[model samples]
Target: MALPYGFVKAKIVSTPQLKSTRRPHEVQYHLHFGITVNGAPWDIAVNVGTTDADDLLKYQLVFDFRHSVLTTLKSTSPGSTDLTGTDALPALDFLRSDFLAKTGAWRNSDVMDGSDQVEPVASLQRLLLRAQQSSLDVYVFGRFYSEGDGVHDVHMNQGSRGEFIHHAGDDSNDHNDIWQDGALLVDLGEPEWALYAAAFDQQYVPTDDLGNPAPGSQPIS
Candidate 1:
């Protein structure tokens, strides 16, 4: 089953809030933000990796992203719109869309939940401040909640590995798909857009048509 992928173009209404998961079954880590769509409250839950040292699939966040898809994302309308089967929207595909440069793009140090450096967290804090101060619009791509109150899974959605290869007793990896990857894009001003892409080190690329990892696929890290 394909996740109900979609996009939410709205304005940031609150600062970034860090939530630490205390349970084993909850979303391990996320940077939540308050947003409004046509006067209705909505939440943007961005995965920021986990603090667990035993977890093999750590987070990888790409900052200052550059790609031609930025041009198409600029013209998107406001509010929430489902892109499950639409060709007008730029449904992201990290491996196939040429969204990521082939060289000098991946760094061994890019992480969202590190305590040593004031990097990604610092960068995201600054982004939220600017977005709030300037009232800039943010484009969030993910699966909207069934209740229609928020959006989550704002990260790469393909090429699962290890235990992620199956879900809901479905051995076919029902959650994975192409052109339905999640992302967070912000429009700063004319000719300037902020694209943030993230994925776990375990998710590989060059997925098949059904999003299963190809025989010789490479990890996104």
Candidate 2:
């Protein structure tokens, strides 16, 4: 039997430095998972893990739990161009149903409009909280363009690559033109969980040229 939705635990295992560019990247991490439905361990994987991080931009995190891939919660950034402009509000909605259906937890999730909202800090926090509640291990592998503002940073410019547009007589574009930079994988192992979460949060915390989380910086939440 599977564990109850909120009975799982989280911890960091390992941390690896990753380089991000306009390309797809993959990283593998080990985890120990313990699931209990009625105070009894139902499923335990000492090494259950996932691969791939190809959708990190549009989704804050791409998690593969027990071979099931889930797109992380996300909100639009400011200055982004969308078909419908100025009417979009960043709120947690698109993935609400999917998340609730998949993990049986919906405490934290959000969607933000890029044109109206400038930051997605609160959305990120909700995602973290939900991840904790569901006991659904997470692996984040992907890259997002930073817009210089800590709070309003993470953004992916898919249109810059002609993904969502098709011009008259244009035949060289594809819908899936987006590239993944890296991925995050979650392990039920306490150590692995902690490491993965730290890496992800650190990356989003904004850094200097040296890639260090800015000092005295409070990440938007």
Candidate 3:
């Protein structure tokens, strides 16, 4: 199934939920949401877990939307992109923090929930709390259904080489052709804001979209 690239400006319609499946063979963590837009209803989820692609890289980035965070984001991701969610954002186009500082891992010292389960949702509540002040600009790739409705793959879309994820090529003929990037932007107030971007390292080009590749797509072998 191919999910197109998209970005939506929306507000939280209800309380978000975090669910994790830790069965050895089916291990993964999910954060789901009920999103409210002026004209449409949307369902979005962020999916990340373990795989043999290279190493375990599950993480969540949260920002406080302070003046300092805003300055960094603007200086880093100054480029304006279409919300179609079809673009790949290079590191220069976004903020890149130290692993320990950005990771929401309990072992990594992230602020954890009271449950403190193995796969915990740290910093999630902290960030969503900020959204209470205003609508969030969510970047996503939506899949429209036959009934003119749909859900969104509201997470990082590139870098997974698994054939199951359609990461190998851009042949539209193939149903598995949805490779993209997404993020959440918060407008704290005039000049203060933040962006939460998730991504994987296995991608050849984080900024490449369908029929387009980032300025550099070659690798050194």
Identify the runs in model 1 with alpha carbons over 4 angstroms from their true place. Answer: 22-27, 53-66, 86-89, 102-104, 108-118, 166-174
Q: Give residue 140's error in model 1 in angstroms.
A: 0.9
lDDT of 2 by residue, 97-122 (tens): 12213322212112222221221233
Q: Which candidate is the best by lDDT?
A: 1
Q: Model 3, residue 50: displacement in angstroms?
A: 5.0
lDDT of 2: 0.25
Better of 2 and 3 by lDDT: 3
Question: Candidates' lDDT values, in order?
Answer: 0.69, 0.25, 0.42
Model 3 lDDT tens row, 149-202: 434334444434444235444434322233334456666556545555444334
Q: Candidate 2 at residue 155, lDDT?
A: 25
- Give me the displacement of residue 217 in model 2, in angstroms: 43
Put the candidates in lDDT order, highest first. Answer: 1, 3, 2
Collision count of model 2: 31
- The TM-score obtained by model 2 is 0.20
